[model samples]
Target: MILRRALWEGLLSLVEDAEDVPWILLGDYNAVIDNSEVCGRAADTSASMTEFRDFVTAAGLVHLPFKGCPYTWHNSSEGSRSLWKRLDRVLVNEAWLGAWPQSSYLSALPRTSDHSPLVVLGIVGAQEAKPFRFDNFLARQASFLQSVASVWRHPIHGTLMYGVVCKLKNLKSVFRSKRKEKGDLASNVRQAKEFLATAQALHEQHKEDIFLVLVKCCRMVYCAAVKMENMMLHQRAKLSWLKHGDQSSKVFFRKINSRRARQRVYQIYNSEGECLTEMHKVTDEFISVFQTLLGGVRRRRTIDLSWLRSDANYVLSTGEGECLILPVTEEEIKEAFFDISEESAPGPDGYTSLFYKAAWPVIGRDVCEAVKEFFVSGRLLKQINATTLTLIPKVQMPSQVSDYRPISCCNVIYKAITKVMVKRLQQVLHLIVDQSQNAFVPEIIADNIY
Candidate 1:
């Protein structure tokens, strides 16, 4: 099944449809081009090899030079384990070949895998070594003076020694003064001019040949010193980058880990159906922890408290199908519904539905019961206040609501039922009123305020 011709053709078609790119295809071919390409004894008419060779030719690909490690595959049969074939190859497209005229492809000896790895190198415009030049050097005063002194003492064997020595002494003094101020190209040039003038004077008083010799000697010393300085500068820069390599690596991995972690969280939060139950089970602890983090989720700054009842209606939409509840507004169901639709894989139900079909009716009933309880409790509280009028004529109201005991066992029942019912009411009020959004107690009171 793995070696079927259709599978090979399908793979090739996939590559052909990819975005235009300069690609170098590399991997074990598992088939030979010719009898010579195979290492172990083989039959001349191997069907797989014949198909592979034809495919390469059809694709207009050329095998590159295989050097150093010739055979790419080996036999693992215990009886006669031997090197067995060169089936691996690297095939580059025309664009790649055009870009790298000098490229060479080769196969390496197999290591862990039965198939050897194919490698490519020396693709056109490969880097070449450049000869060092004196002009590229840079140095400070101290080094420049030292180089001058060495040249003077050495005298290049046969060059004029007397003039070179006089130039060296003048340059040494100039460098010492320049070093005190600061060393730079401007200062170096100034020192060179002064030394040249002194040498010219000495030559005029002595011999013309000596003047020319001293001029040449000074220029050569300056060039050598400058080159040495540049080399040192280059080394310092490279060393700095090498020292910070670990820091750069840490930054790279940090970004990758952060991105992957956020993606996982989003995937969980946006899932639905049985997956949502799983997501809640897995991420509820994290959400609870996040809730502890102050200001993690922001409340809308400007809430439309005036239009809350109307806005709430827009949010509550009727369910459409088996998974959907009938009474809840369509928009209210969208959140749960859409969440399930976007996961990489379907939820536990193996279907992508926005709302949990079986669960929606239950959720809808809960919302309706809660809203009704809020109004009922609010009405009961008003009735109790009216009844207190005759009995409280000689009595004074308590200083605080907490000081008042529940009227009776029935009063306690009202409080318990109202408290449980207000949870959604608190959420709804929070969404509508800007002031009440972060204040849960106000919403709880508002739910029963009527």
Candidate 2:
């Protein structure tokens, strides 16, 4: 037990000192994760298992999913004395999993030994279809707006949410088409500028109407393309300085490249201390880890609320209570929708606040109706509430999943609804909440200072 603890400590120290690279620590851990991992025995729910669990959690290790036989080790004894346990397996950290998302682990049958030999396979170079993401720069194009209006105006029979989803899907196709038509913006800008310069020179020498008009049109196209490219870089970089006239695409591009490199994960260790490079195995490891985390034992403990009743100062006024549960209104909904920043990132729906603000005349009624329906039914479509969770690294060269903070990007519709509810709550919150707790309450901090 002392030797095992020393080994565990050493492994952790190594991980702490190692560079932020993909790591997999696999082989005979000689420990079963849970009761399911052992057979022909009641299972050891003891201090050893507790220490093993703590080691895994503290080390930020993720167990890889095994294919074929679950039990990798077995005692060669009679039925009564026989024992089987998953002692040999694979484990990896988040950095490794990120590097090889599709890696897989396979447990090969033991030929002569009690332990099974494991093989890790990397991801095959298979092309996957990219998901749809709305480009803010697209909004700058007049034809893009026309295309959106045309598709959105088409009638669809369903719930407000369903109709909105369908219209957005159709608009995706339109945007794809528009993207193809636009070709490459960088190339377009360069070619246009070249043509404009030549045409201007010709017009200056010959004083020809055709050359002058050509120069004017080409110059306008070039400027528009440059502006669109700048907007795209601005959106992608998300730098505060970029918002205020710092329009250096080269600087922004460099920052974007550095960020991507930092985020990319490339290697990991498996059981038996073997390093895995296969993409499939890495992917399997991550899936297994998350499933275990999200589907683990649920222990509910009852908490005593008796102490809260002793505090008489927490009572709310009759008017304040009424305001808390008040029905949402269209005016409040509109205010919430407009309250969101136009530059705020869009959700999975691929519709941004800018799109809604620009095309409010055509889509406002449907959006308003959708929000009202949600309030009335007290339910919303799954897609509307669906959020994309992005991991932001909290430290430089983070090796574990815990080192990154998960931020959920919810749909604009969801944000609008929540914003309105928050505004309504703000009016009554100050009256009910204690003055010491001044997080969302307006002027509470200043009042306390005075």
Candidate 3:
């Protein structure tokens, strides 16, 4: 028992080595944290469980949520003497959780072994796709709405989604022109400052009304130029915590370069165990691995949910169920867009929530129509369903594809649709979810559960 306690302490010490960086610790510790994890005759393990729980608390780790076989280890004994326990686990610190917020894992039942096999499933990594990054800085400009309005005004003859997609494509050029007109952000800032300085000098030399007015105008231009440049840096850096004007240009540059370096997957081991270092081979490996993983049994049994009604404290009424299925309203769509953070990552369309909000007046009717068509027809345009898979490195020197995390960056339109549906779900959540189930229930927290 003393030696077991030492194991827990040793693991905790290893976590300490990572400091504040994102880190994960996964393996079979031969320990269980809860009594519910055990089945059949077993010796008292409360001491071991407490020590393991303590170690987890000390390290500030959350159990990486997993699906599949719950009891990972079974003592192969039959009938009354059978024993089963979830001995394997994947624990990650808060920093790791923050880094890959939607990350999880999978545990498969053992075919020829005593313990289940674990698979780290952090979104699984991105597929190699053509780059099309829509700069948020472009959306913030004065003529930005005008540029969007110009293309969006012309109606394309096809699916509602097709029209939107085409308009977005055309706007790329409009935006390109706008960006060119605005010129290089760094150069713009420098020139604006120079102009401001010159104006101030001329005003100082001659105390005339015209010179004073010119000086004030130049000062405004300089400030605006600096603000635009800062916005560009902030968007690219993806450092949300960094303040807007904390003299963070150098920091932003460093962060962007670092991210670019980590995203490149130069090598991967294929299904045949052959190592491939070429970029094309690596991309093909990602595609093959994901296809196999996602292709599951098409034949499935229909779940009997009638039993849920009996177990639940309360169930949704007929009216509540009907309301949930009702077609979404334009007001609801607008609300969803407004609810999302403007800085939230853009999908394949390269436009964030801010674009919709700014161009809402001009595009609201068409936007609402495009969203409404989905509910009415029960079909989605392929363009609307398009997603960009982004790969983020999980280790200092990643060797396998699993060493990278997968992040699905869906388009803004798709998110808006989901957001509206989620809002509807929230209305009936309390009625359907039992009070005992605290997590994910709106306004209910699991503070009492320790």
List per-prediction Cα lDDT, in the order shown.
0.43, 0.74, 0.78
Locate the minimum summed-lDDT window of 10 residues in model 1: 386-395
Writing each residue's lDDT as its tens digit, candidate 3 over 403-443 gives: 77878988888999999989999988867766566567755
Q: What is the per-residue lDDT of model 2 for residues 303-383, given as tens digits with 9 covering 90 to 100?
A: 555766577467667877787777777788888888888667778776777777766777788888888888888878888
Q: Could you give the C-alpha RMSD of every candidate to the true structure, in order shown?
A: 34.6, 14.7, 13.7
> Residue pairs in steric clash, candidate 3?
125-406
lDDT of 3 at 412: 86
TM-score of each: 0.26, 0.65, 0.66
Residue 448 deviation, candidate 1, in Å?
99
The better candidate by TM-score, 1 or 3, is 3
User: What is the C-alpha RMSD, rounded to one decimal, of candidate 2?
Assistant: 14.7
Measured on C-alpha atoms, candidate 3 has an lDDT of: 0.78
Highest lDDT model number: 3
**How do the candidates rank by TM-score, highest first?**
3, 2, 1
